[model samples]
Target: MKALLSSRPVLWFLFLFNLVVAAVAPFAVDGTQGLVTAAGMGAVSLGAGAGLLRGHGQGA
Candidate 1:
């Protein structure tokens, strides 16, 4: 779990995925759909960050 979380490629993939989602979100939909898109992206970003932070603490 720690190794996976600390992996650079995994982190980059998540970052890129979030970027793509965020970039497409505004133009791909509207109203509730837009809100949902934003929320989903936010959740992914938050989860990745939280996991990395937790893993970093454990590693030290």
Candidate 2:
């Protein structure tokens, strides 16, 4: 369970999930824009994935 929680796949999954939520946030609001938020979330996810990949390499 600990291994699964710390896995890169899990990290990536969470990041992607956040991105998806950000993308859909605009529709939830009456007049809010979601593109910028989505873009920011995407950037964060990309960075997280990259960081996880790098950490995995160092451990192996």
Candidate 3:
């Protein structure tokens, strides 16, 4: 588990993929529902995922 967490490629992939989904998902829908989901996903990826990525890079 620690080994996997330390893997840069895997961490980067997870980070970028979630970010992409957050960016593109809003456009995939046409109503307030889409906007709400996008906001939630964006917060998770840009907020939480960013913290993970930063901690990983800093070896925290």
Candidate 4:
């Protein structure tokens, strides 16, 4: 588990894939619900994932 998480290539793949999820999230549901889902859930997860990927690079 840690091995894959610490791998640069795997991290990059996950980061990019998360962006796809964020893009589609805005249309996964109806009306304001979908927008909320995208901004709240999707964006939060994206921020955390980005931090994880970048943290490793900056030696955090």
* Collision pairs in model 1: none
What does candidate 1's lDDT look like per residue over 1-60, in tens digits?
Answer: 977866756765776688678668868888888778877886787677666666675534
The 0-to-1 C-alpha lDDT of every candidate, in the order given, reads 0.72, 0.70, 0.70, 0.67
Best by lDDT: 1
For model 4, residues 1-60, the per-residue Cα lDDT tens digits are 987675666666666676676678777887887777667756655765776756665642
RMSD of each: 3.4, 4.1, 3.3, 3.8
Give the poorly placed runs of model 1, Cα more than 4 Å off: 1-8, 58-60
Among residues 3 or more apart in sequence or in different chains, the pairs in candidate 4 whose N, CA or C atoms overlap within 3 Å are none
Error at 4, model 2, angstroms: 17
Ranking by TM-score: 1, 3, 2, 4
Worst 10 residues of 3 by lDDT: 51-60
Worst 10 residues of 1 by lDDT: 51-60
Ranking by lDDT: 1, 2, 3, 4
Residue-wise C-alpha lDDT for candidate 2, range 35-58, written one tens digit per residue = 667667778777767767777766
Q: What is the lDDT of residue 22 in candidate 3?
A: 74
Better of 3 and 4 by TM-score: 3
